[model samples]
Target: MPLYKEIVCNENAKLYLWKITEEIEFFKHAVLLKDVSQKRVDAMKSESHQKGFLAVRMLLQHVGYTDFDLYYDAFGKPHLSDGKCISISHSHTFSAIAISDQPIGLDVEQVKEKVLKIASRFMDVSHLENLSDAEKMKKATVIWGIKESIFKIKNETGISFPKHIFEEEFNLESKKTIAQLQFNAKTENFNVVFDSVEEYIYVCAFEVDPNFLQ
Candidate 1:
């Protein structure tokens, strides 16, 4: 499929998803890549990774953008020539991009038992109590996505997922929650929204603005 899903995170941001069903040639024929991008894609050992990178470029075109408008920072975070914020993620069979006028984060993780296995390393286990096996897996994946999204927004080194990012207790039914990033002697809160697409959980986070709350 071309564009698998599109979610309007808010007035300023939107998430575009592409389900990876096409082969490498399909994406190569569908979009153009900058020379640097092409070289990076050429160096990928896995064809899946190459497809994911091209899928993101396909999404850029869907949003009226092309690879020419995109660039990466020293940290490998993506930036747009137009000054809009962009975050990219891909796992397994899915790839996504989030674009916004304000700083934002995006993550997509397939639900799996592995996340629950190492949940302690990145999150509080108390929040997972009393859920069925399936629920536990999904929730753990969501929390993981929350932390990842926040990290993208901060884009700073030495930030430990377990030590620095914390997700408040939230019901899966609510499909939203609050998270805190405590690092560098500062604490910051983010407004998080998440939803499940197919078997993957996608989350987007926007830094909380106290003035906007007022």
Candidate 2:
């Protein structure tokens, strides 16, 4: 029940962060998960869910949702009976969820070197050309998060990066960034917000109503 922080992104959207100590029982009862995986169960054994159910349950709580009565679509996209659009992402000991009245996507990634090696696959040559040594790593990770968020929203995987998706760079000092996604025969776009946590980076993208798609 301990909320670490909350960010008011807009009148319609808000983000929250929670720190779970010995409150594992909170999730156990909240989700009604009888036989969660050992990894998840073990996370309860500790103060966190290391790739476990804690993340999901915490997310549910953040959105003021209590019903464990939920199911996943064919692509593993979580669906609620009320039809609220939601997306989730988790890393090591932390997890994040984004819920919105409109279609939204979210991703949390541990900043690591592996993202650098795969940058070329997801980032266009033009993007690579504009990066300096230090900027490249951060830029690549942001791109990965952007694509991941898009994939979650689309409910499909294996989408080619850089090739199929594109992002318009924003000054890190700015309040928002823009990401544009193009699939086989369709194109959509969103306004994204980026945040830098301790060792991880989080990105959220949602459609700009009346002018854009999510």
Highest TM-score, which number? 1
| TM-score of each candidate structure, all chains considered together | 0.96, 0.78
Per-residue CA lDDT of model 2 for 1-214, tens digit only, reads: 4555666654566665544453555565555443433344765554544433565665665566743545567778877668877776777656666667777788877778787787777686456566675556666677788888877777655577667778886555564677777876778877777777776777887885544323
lDDT of 1 by residue, 156-204 (tens): 9999999999988998988988899999999999988899998999999
**Strongest candidate by lDDT:** 1
The per-prediction CA RMSD against the true structure, in angstroms, equals: 1.7, 4.0
Off by over 4 Å in 2: 19-31, 34-51, 67-69, 125-134, 209-214
Candidate 1 stretches greater than 4 Å from native? 209-214
